[model samples]
Target chain A: MPVDHKRINGPENTIPYKLYTKLNVKSFKEALQDAVKNGVRNDKRKLDEHRRIFMKTDIVSQAKGSAYIEIGNTKVVVSVFDPREIPNKNEYSLNGELYCEFKFAPFSCPKRRLHQQDAEEKQNSIVMKQALEPAVCRHEFPNFQVDVYALVLENDGSALSAAITCAGLALAQAGIPMFDIITSVTIGIQGDLKLLDPMLHEETLCYTSINKNSKTGKNSHGIVILSLLNTHQQVTEFYQVGSLDIDDIEECTKVLTEANKVVVPLVEKCLAKHVIKGVKESSQ
Target chain B: MTLSEAEKTFILHGVQENFRIDGRNRDDYRPMELETSIITHAFGSARLRLANTDVVVTVKVEIDVPFPDRPLEGKMEFFIDCSANATPDFEGRGGENLATEISNTLTAAYSSNSVFDYTKLCILKGRKCWKIYVDILILECGGNLYDAISIAVKAALWNTSIPLVKSVTIDGNNVDMNVSENLSDCIKLDISAAPLMVTLCKIGDHCVVDPTSAEEQCSQGAIVVAISKGKFSTVFQTGGGSLHPLTLMEKLKLGAKVGNRLEEALSEALSKIKENGEMGFLN
Candidate 1:
């Protein structure tokens, strides 16, 4: 691996001290079982309830459009830059291309992240681009490229969905033509319990396959993230990990779609506030 | 590759008529040839050729400590390298995006423990474990890269023979193990539940599997579904276009059906493979 001199690099193989702590020494299966008690999450949220979201537009003055969003402990900021000519391509493109970058702050997670984008971040970038592309009117700005950057300040959970939601807001704030507002949500399934908008710890537990105690060989556990265009009722991007039956997936999608609907009005209200403020300023 | 508008329209019309540019129908796949144990140096390797698309997958294993969170499970990683020989666009870091996408998909597809048992690879609980590295090199790109790569990976894994461990002794923080030196004393991976990816390209209101480059250019959207043991291990939407919920569900069902048939065909072909000498790119 190439050394990054720009930022202070930690020791080559420094594990998080939390791993050695007594509280976390227990097996993940035990921890997973303890995550939810009496239909309430560790953080005291309902099984299908989402964390309160705080959103603001035009936070970054330098960018053409920018939005900052916070869902519980997860904080993400997205910025959209003005359309520019394609960098290396010489051929004329019939549709505008989107360049998306998803990054995590070095101190975002429990463990220190590298300055460079890792495999997970790169994959998230592609997912973000796919989720936002269908909503953007690429034909409106043919032969141009729009750059979108998402930075996770603190990743508690559902950072990718938060970034997707923020990116849509940023694009709308930038006055980019769009079909509809794009909202995204993540659902984590563990056995028969489904946790909507899973926190970081809950997400990790769902990702680990530790249903050895179950009598049946099949165990349902996974994380599903879906991005929806509200007006069109289309799924722009869907990504899933872990083992899930088709029936489980069908139920999860239905739950996720409803979860996305809950977020649509919140996002629209934020954008509406921005629009109303802009109109008031121009009128004054 | 860039296609002319006229060509795109022609392909679109063909898809609408249920006849592809090639003689194959919408669901039919091109002829594919698979060869395993091609790389002698690697523990296991396979090369697959699906018409103009070519992929070489090699599996190498190394002993390492398991993750603290999931100590009972070993690790499996997928790495993709797009050779410049396949296309000029893949030179330098140009292929990084495509490489990352394919590797990520493979990673997710194989993440399920039931699909490829990770506990079998663990030598000791919370201690030593085998980390399998699946490196895929794309020698050519026709289209339907996901399906070809996944099939080649499964074949390579099937050919892999993990060295058997005789015993292990741990003292405080130090650990030692005895591995069998006999070449024949090895364990084979149970890959029956290994997932196979099928890409369903939506073109002109119809879905097609194993599309060629020409047909790929005409697709409005594409869904890559990874099926393992008749269950969905992963489902991803690629490309720029979006699809309605109904269309997405329809394509997922179609992909699963095609994936199961392809899985059967591949396993049968794998069983028929003989230890033929002097095989590879040379042959």
Candidate 2:
């Protein structure tokens, strides 16, 4: 839906959807079982399996630094160009030049469409930008914007998560120094059944449940989108379940671990392919 | 928009020779990138990019009393917001006028019955109907805003899901909508007739579909055609320059062909969208 401030009729729609999302899943346990069965094969490997990631540096001809990553059907092309000179003189961040845009072609989705960034996409872009900040060596680059434009032509799921991993890979690929990889995962809870890497269908079922009873209500399956740092895999950025309880948090943690099982390796594989071999991290 | 001599000359030269810097023929559109179901939060969402010009569209539905005049037909509205990142020119409210113009154009393009069936959104006669809000957020402007916005809006709509109201309680004036508890208890809008806008920009003696920002500045005039289900839903003119009747017809044919290709490609892409969680910036 196109968000128009002037039109009062539609904003209600956006707000209500976010709030009272009804559940499509029959039960949380059923959804979880379905996800596990559908996402991974009998052998335990993911069905639409993303391969081991590999990253390399200086791939962008015109960019100062760049990286390329492929995770199954998910592929990201990022270019860390010169720190964009922010023209607004009065405004400056001690963190240095920084800008990130996440984009997907209509061709990227199963259904094609025109190009327009909406609220969810915008939020995701900002989330990705934030997730990349600590992970990239922005101090070394300074005063210059690192343009990390992620293009997903094919989607298996977990886009922002992939983008975070991909951006880190790109930073390393560009030979831009970095601290750690910012890996992300999307975990969902139906009832007692918690799952990871919820795809479009699963998401639909998921939201139906979450939207219906947001609180400790019976059919609530809130989203648990989290960003993690690679050193021992700790949480850095989090937008976990909203208004849920401690028990729910525990359920989400289990799902998060399950997500990492699929995502962590993909990040490493991409890093291996794109990052330069001999550029040692400074230890001053 | 003001044009610089060097930029203008560069575009004019490319148009004169029937070639764009991106290597697209004057009549050829830039490679379009489209994704559907990208935004999990929204019931239906799609992102379309015509080269650097990008638009993200999300469709949200809600129950509301119908307009006094159009009670049977549900409401459909368009909202366009131009991001400052696209260009400094769009900073603050600078792009409001343009945004309004494009949104109005879109509304008009999709208003006709042939383009979109508004009655399908009606739940109760004059009581409640699905008010679909097409939120268009322009991230970048490479040119051809009309076509990009229109296509993205349509895609987002096609991806929209109106909650199947199992029942409704008429509590005097305060009515209550009983939403279906069944997860698959839903209805999908058949948007095959939804129109896709194709822009024809005139250059020298010929017209081109999907012009870049530079060429848009150089164009004397342009036309926007909204085609639905292989038929021309609506055709209107844009830009400062006007067009001859004969030339407009010729361009209309070209626009229709392009629209067909776009619709086919879009349908195929949309059909391929899996329930898998493969979305976001990193594909």
Candidate 3:
């Protein structure tokens, strides 16, 4: 009965586990070349095309405002609580606080997540907060803190972008004042192929490996996530993983900004629907 | 969530009269929506929504060495996470205490051999075994958390399919296991004896099952009874109020009866559930 040892509280084992058996695996360079030559991806989407997105707001009844976003297999739910007095606040401050906690459900990913938020999740939480900080009208609720909790129900890829986008919609649905709508998109780059909203497999295949043999040209295959304030045309936050050349980074940012433009209308439509439903209910 | 004295009196009188605030009888449960195999990555998963209280349970299995003391038994672990989205109070580590209490209660309820046969999970008896991780996420809190969690866990376990082991090679201190390659080659657990927990809250001398958050606040005391195959697997008193011996017996009886009915209904729903259908929070 190895049950007792399993019951003990300890840090989760961080060892990675492979979900699919590696068979007929194509090298990173070959995969990149195939995408560039054939103009098609494994999922059959064009290199610059994104997965279909499904967005809805006011899904969680308990939270003041909530939204559920599903982009292909990636599903994330974000809830925004009502603003409250900042805990541990002794002196008055003009800036309102934004608290974000991003978590992946224990069974959301290929690997089981621990009950506690891990380092990656904590970093994402901070990134999310920073992404939405400039968009929100903090001066309206000075000395108060608005809590945003994003839970990834399923993670295929581009989860952080989905969270940021979903959180912005949730805040708007919660009736929090904001300067403009915020939207985000993630771009995966491998060689000359640029994938918009790449699925988990494509993302891992493109970004996880770095070509060690390259000594002259750019060997950077990486991911770039950009949060944009659509109306104001401002880049609120930009997060990049892996090494990339200046040209590649510029191209990725341009593609990601374009993708964000496509997502903003969807977010606006969801918020409008929420507001319409609220008005109808009140009238009835 | 404070209730006025008037509200408490109304609830107390309603319970005594066998009619709850929401028009449900003493033993009546709230309408529940259950969906299974929701998480694609998990071996088994289920989401149960009893009114506003939502719980999702996922089962993950791994191979591990058997304990020296219980050489013939496998392992089953329960982890409960209280999502901050459920309530603002659960922010940071604020919900740790409640999460621990619920997980501990589930462990006790499933500890009985009759409730869940752990030996069935054993692979190489004494040497190696399959470790099952039952992770529960509380998405909302309406009330009767114990009952909702138990139902979700049972459904998740029922939906669980352990990968079929093809072969095992023992090489001195090392052992290797080969699992079947076919995706459908798996074993589904027999959950006929899985326990179902029922919470009976005593309000003004009368016990009521499936107490909502408001009724829970009005309850003087409550008993959580875990019933498996018409037998009590575990019983624990909750809340701060005390109960007399006679009252306790009465509440236990009510809990057992409700628990059995719940178990039957759950099995019936599970059997009716189609393998592939529209599921998850979308619907």
Candidate 4:
């Protein structure tokens, strides 16, 4: 059944996307308007340039590992549950581990979505699992699978980015040893500008620009999904530009390369504080 | 609550001694946390967490042709989704029954003219009208779901800013709407008469408001009373257990009293939202 966007009874949380409305297929007009409104400003920064960020772990006492990360208005809480045995073997992957869910709760949208899981949610879980695989040395914790749940409690834009950033923090909070801390950043291009951390409005109007024949726009309009290895301060896995081809891959590496530079120290700072807190708590 | 002997003894002793299960008196309400304007893209929305129960409500307004029979009346629909966040039992398609029941109750409660004036929502008789959609999401079920949902819905309605529709044109059967550009020129729904739900759980001979999950499991039955303007908008008696007419009447009285208090509290909360206000989940 087609989920009616307006009918879903969730929360009345308004996410500002109306700032990017297109009159027609000439989405360039809207993109240009947005570029003028948000892109041209001196505040418009590029990929690899990171915002001041912070994260904390063990905020939710009950959760196995819970952490909160903030990237401007994008605040997310990620929690990791101890690896549990699979309920149904039929659905299991090659590895014994299974079960991952990501959700922007009903109230997370301006127009509430039905709380039931949908294709978008399923796709997000896959992305989350893929980003997490490289960071989590799953071989040691075999026969069991950890549930990495990311809740976008507040989304300014770049939720996928926040999810990657927050997931590693949660794993660390849960005391799960990992090779590195993972951070993701989304970069969108509109004409002569590249916007770092495209807000909810920017992402919505992005597709319309692709509908137009702006090849250069397509190059910059690409998305870079990166997972950071905290110790190495490196990009372990990268997923980018599903719709665009090799030639159309406008801007590459800058977002992930930049994200690694900006995000590594922030993650380390949080981890150090968490370690100190754990020692203090155990002593108490 | 149809408590076992030991449980009954414990509760009675606690109530008499001024300490109930969650360590509070009979009249004590659960802690409430409310977050507003969180949904950045919605017309208006709010989340209310009363204890462990979480309710998220959003309001969306769309223009549509008014019903032929009710030419001057607009449309307002209430839909509730019993989400899995409440419990594992609500996973997948399992929560439909509870969701439908809650939505039906909300529909009935808001059916009265005094509760929500549909006529005011009309643009042109039989030509154009504003249909307000109120969507409710139940996240966690600590207890007192009805009360939390109702309060959140009311607050969301108050926060709703209906776009100021400019000069609606009707040509034969076709209707053309012109929307105003002024953001400040918006109509706010007057929800002073909006109904508040009071869930009265029958625990032995007494009835309790806002019963916990264990208390609910122990109860024989529960009655949902929707009160607006000090009048009964709807009374829904749910669960399998039956009660005598006299007992039902007594429960109705308790519901009425509780309903009044709820209405008062809701109005006070909504008014405070208009003034300098502060609330969130961190507390």
Candidate 5:
């Protein structure tokens, strides 16, 4: 007798499994238009508007410095440790090192994540390291390495951008000398519509190509995450998923850079509060 | 963290005189704060802070096949991850050894049927059962890790809400379970018989219940005793020191006495916890 795998092993499927079934049942073009129409997105935000941000510093007492950030439903916490001598490197170098580790708690996302860091998490860590290396004064502490760990407590959308923003704030709070602070934003492109700080549902729809006309086979859909050094007006790191036209890419980049600027002031205000508190404690 | 000879003498004399550095008696514990149902996505969750040590536990439930030998029983697993935020030494894979040690100790303590009833988790005797995954994340380590972890695990288990099985239809090796659709239709686990572990650190000729990091370094040996109800469920020795039989027996007696009191205090705290209270790292 042949065993029925669908009946026995199918109970463990997650929400994504149900989502795929629903997608196949409906017309793709109709859903796309419903998500974006009449100068507003599904969440009732304007085309270029970003989500509300809440940020704080010195949340984790164990770490040397820490920050917690929340944008809409996404929550991220970053902790920075004191600088230490680079391990397993017998020879000395002039430039200091920055080690980044990005992790999502097992219960952070809709689907359960494994305890070990997956490949996507490793890639995000490298992106974070590259984004902050130029802004940080690595030559200040020769032969030493600073460790930064970012953990996502809840991942609704744009989690990597939140991590980058929080990690930079944590490093500054640790008193590491930096040329300037870095900020990041995510942009979602679908057809002629551009969504800023898209939610989880909008993000998934943006990634899936829904060609209004199947005969043309032409679809412009992608997600771009960009980190910017606002003080210097330079792009530090850029990552994109899926395919988009050259013209659409340029349009998305311009919108994301402007969005990044809106977040810088929030970060500055949080850091200023932390500094004032420290000065007050030392004087007393 | 090396201590000089004079510093060691100070700690030894302090323990002998019963005047600890923090002014606590031998069987006293530090102040602890506990919050449950913190993680929104998990079936059950809890966060515990014992002075400087912080631990978060989340429980996830899934349907799984019962073991061939034990058809009526369910399964429970413990996974521990030590975050680098606690200390630089736990970076990367460096904390694997400590994580393994803590998880193994928990597995041993929960292995007995009397300590935690596994049959309550069963949906269908020989076909399907509920597998509980208890994931523990250690954010900080001050000392007395075993005692802190055991208490947090018990509290998290108490907070767990397993979905009620409305019906189970079996058709020739195919089992289909219909769980209750209402969110409030769930069963809370009965954790009264769950074991509580107490770490007794022998300093000089006396033993202490909660030892700070400095005192842990000065102690000669330590014994972790897990008590379920009035009996010992599991007892094990740790650290690099030898213990005389007489002193070992004395420490075991002290551990049992402290374990019972700790269980009573924990259950009291759990009962006082209000539903929908403010919970998380923010406060």
Candidate 6:
């Protein structure tokens, strides 16, 4: 058996199938204009509207705790494993550790992704860990490590924020002690237009500087993702990209803080529903 | 690397009093030494030393095809390597997390077209372009790695020179181009809007810039703000602590203020630096 069998063979370079579609014939500028017209997006959502969210817990039977969430076309599943002894450590630790892994399924995006984690996924894992660390009471399980794995089944946009929210729910479902429920939101900025919970197309438009304003040199374009602990009113994680003015950042923060509130009630309701179901089954 | 309770208390008290172990104020940065063109083999190179932290950055370029979507723009990447010489824990894959974080921050900061124009590197639309690889090596880690790395990367980019393309001809599916043979006939990168990162470590109720390792341990949370020109390119919160929204905004303000001053100082230093004939590791 002299064949190279370590990995499956594939095309040297594969372009996304979406690129060959006839619907993508228009120029990007015209497409961007069509994405949002007359204060309404192509999806008919308002400028500050968020995509409908569906969340559920206890999806993975093998895992200690698991959650699945869907924000429009983007779907993510997060599983949390029980705390185990920390690996390769001899001394005691004052606080427990969290191991986060964020992965995108091969068929999740428009283009096929590799099995191995890419740089973007690795960075998302770190952000996920940081976002959840403050809410978890790590001192209770010192010298132990809890593993949280997030898999993006479909990535339309705001996948990281969805994963963070799902991970928080999974941690809570796993009986992990926490200070408060965490909710995250993403906002896309393009010039003066601010879209809340943007889809993939709007996100791309905001990312690119196609319509840059050169006069002021203050290009208000980028993405701002904020994770908030509602109870304490503390921000667990804040990640931003692109170039923006100070006032724009402040406004974005304010808008994101408010936007985060929209998802808190939904998360709380889901957890409460799960708890009641468990109680009913036990009573029976 | 572990500090005792007494040592922690001492540092906390010093922070509360607006004084630090190194006798610096809340916003005071440690003295820095910067040298450019240290790597003769690299197209451009720079080494920056801020007190105990040290970093080296080099820029390399190669001819490559541009992305289909953005054919007018070239490509740029940031790769950070944390050497074991910086610390024993960085051996093998231990430093990968930190390396990825720093590199990702740099990528986000430079993603904006206004920050660094990529179209200038394109030799032929959608066919040929120059792909720049900025490699950074962390020789030591005292604290404030982001700030130090950003400064070195800016300096290296400033020192970089791209070879000019003489001409290009496309026939059917094949393309041919002639590059300038003259060594001095090259175009320099425009680094005027290059972003520089400033880490604001929140200690007690005050935020400090350029914190030492000891000071980093005593902080609650920190924010890294990358400023380009007068606007902010990226703002990231790191560490395992949470911050109030008010405190976060205040830290951002402080970071911007300090970043402007840093940008000014860096420009001043860069202007004063002349291409010295004798410059290398031996110096």
Q: What is the TM-score of chain B alone in each candidate?
A: 0.96, 0.92, 0.96, 0.90, 0.96, 0.97
As for candidate 1, its clashing pairs are none
DockQ (C-alpha based) per candidate is 0.75, 0.01, 0.01, 0.01, 0.01, 0.80
Q: Candidate 2 at B101: error in angstroms?
A: 1.0
C-alpha lDDT (0 to 100) for residue A164 of candidate 2: 72
* Model 6 whole-model lDDT (C-alpha atoms): 0.90
Ranking 2 against 3 by lDDT, winner: 3
Q: Which stretches of candidate 4 lie over 4 Å from their true place?
A: A1-284, B1-18, B274-283
Error of 6 at B110 (Å): 1.1
Which wins on lDDT, candidate 4 or candidate 5? 5
Cα displacement (angstroms), candidate 6, residue B87, comes to 1.4
Across A1-284, the per-residue lDDT of candidate 5 in tens digits comes to: 12344543333333444434665455557877777789887778898998899999999999998999999999999999999999866568678988888899978976677666665676577667767776688889999999999999999889999999999999999889987888889887776778899877778777655663365755566677777778777566655554454456556667877888899999999999998999999999
Q: Residues B12-68, candidate 3, lDDT per residue (tens digit)? A: 888888888899998899999998999999999999999999999999999887765
lDDT of 3 at B35: 89
lDDT of 5 by residue, B232-251 (tens): 55555554333433355567
lDDT of 6 by residue, B4-91 (tens): 9899899988988988899999899999999998888889999999999999999999999998767789999999999999988788
What is the descending TM-score order? 6, 1, 3, 5, 2, 4
Candidate 2: residue A57 lDDT (0-100): 48
- Candidate 2 A-chain TM-score: 0.69
Model 4 DockQ, alpha carbons vs. true complex = 0.01
Question: Once model 3 is optimally superposed onto the true structure by TM-score, how far is the C-alpha of residue B213 displaced, in angstroms?
Answer: 0.5
- Runs with alpha carbons beyond 4 Å of true place in candidate 5: A1-284, B280-283
Candidate 6 chain B, which ten residues in sequence have the lowest lDDT sum?
B274-283
lDDT of 3 by residue, A49-143 (tens): 88899999989999998999999999999999999999855668677878889999988987678767765686577568777887888889999
Candidate 6 lDDT tens digits, A225-249: 9999987999999999988888888
